[model samples]
Target: MRGSVEHSWGWGHCAPSPLLLLTLLLFAAPFGLLGEKTRQLLEFDSTNVSDTAAKTPGTPYPPYSLADFSWNNITDSLDPATLSATFQGHPMNDPTRTFANGSLAFRVQAFSRSSRPAQPPRLLHTADTCQLEVALVGASPRGNRSLFGLEVATLGQGPDCPSMQEQHSIDDEYAPAIFQLDQLLWGSLPSGFAQWRPVAYSQKPGGRESALPCLASPLHPALAYPLPQSPIVRAFFGSQNNFCAFNLTFGASTGPGYWDQHYLSW
Candidate 1:
């Protein structure tokens, strides 16, 4: 077509180089919002690890855990039924004994229109269980953001994921299982005791009733510890090898939106 109208009238006599307009505005945005701004520059910052925990002793960080992930320019609207969870400092349904068994798991998997909107650093444990402490009790209740519309993209296919670069095969069966949350036996509970208030969230058990793997409960289990410190327990696991496999898409509201204004703007 005459070289596409002479390449748009020869670039209309030029005027666009700010590195070509910042590489055309970063290829016109959205690789899942640049992978959620590279996960807010790689998430996990529990008060900068408790303000350097007395000059780092065993600081591999991540105690009460927090990674809601919602790059709508910050949104923890605070009213999805607030309760405020706590532990070590008490009141997370306290029955004393420094918090019991502990259970509250909701980080789901189910919403597949063939995997809609998810693809960014779907990380969650694979480096020898970080500290292998079983992170006492269990809970996943904090606004329930739903891992930013979920995604378990196995960066490099499985069989212990060696090489990478396989963007979409729907899922490469939870790949390159590499988890390293550093670990100095991470344990924190200050500031309203971190998180996990409401309870009862279970799924991972493959008994074929439309499975929901790794959320919680399989006869009361949320990973255990605290019975003379020699105690142990693990309930709800279905698809081991460090379970992680995603593609639970659904996220759309870039510029002038609707879908009830991105579902009531919250």
Candidate 2:
């Protein structure tokens, strides 16, 4: 009878002990936080200069200007708009780390442009574990493609972003050519009712200036929310040309932990 007892524990039958299970879960806790906390760095530089001239705009938009932001016209031939512009030092710019009201403001008339090309806009955070909540408000007269979104250039353990090059060239070998966040609009302005739609841009692909959409993964569908019409967007007109306007603001802060091991294991 003892000889007839069934036995098949040679392999693949080991059970996970309680201690082993606890250790495994502890290793996964930080990773769980990684996903929900990661934030997307929407780079606002000149390399992503508007290609169209700022003249009689409709479909073809113009490039942004540096002088508009009180900087020398560093970019040539490209004519974007800057109807009204203002800038102040960032809070971090202070050596004391004291809380100071460091902010920029602009008011664009309808059919005008508003650009911050020189002192490229930035969305800063203490850690990469975060999310971006952007609300674009349009006021005054509205123009075609009256929308606001983000442009990303992935830099993995690299230095600052490359100098913005002409529409046809680039200096940063790791530059990205595609605009990742597509919260675009193409109609008249609505009341200021737009809310922050969360998104996750996984910085996976890291190389060249063209492999954009493929480099990073788009985490959600194109955001769909009601448009806002109050606080008219300050339009920026190009060198004696067309007009366009909009404002960007971050509203909420959240921790990360949704997609850690899934896409950001590194």
- Candidate 2: segments with Cα more than 4 A from true spot: 1-58, 63-128, 140-145, 157-266
Which candidate should be chosen as best, given TM-score against the real structure?
2
RMSD of each: 23.6, 26.2
State the lDDT of candidate 1 residue by residue for 178-247, as single tens digits: 2211111101321010011011112221112211112111111112321111011011112232211222
Query: Cα RMSD for candidate 2?
Result: 26.2
**Residue-level lDDT tens digits of model 2 in 34-95:** 11111121222222224332222123233222122221122221223421111111223333
lDDT of each: 0.18, 0.20
Q: Over all chains combined, what TM-score does candidate 2 have?
A: 0.18
Clashes of each: 11, 36
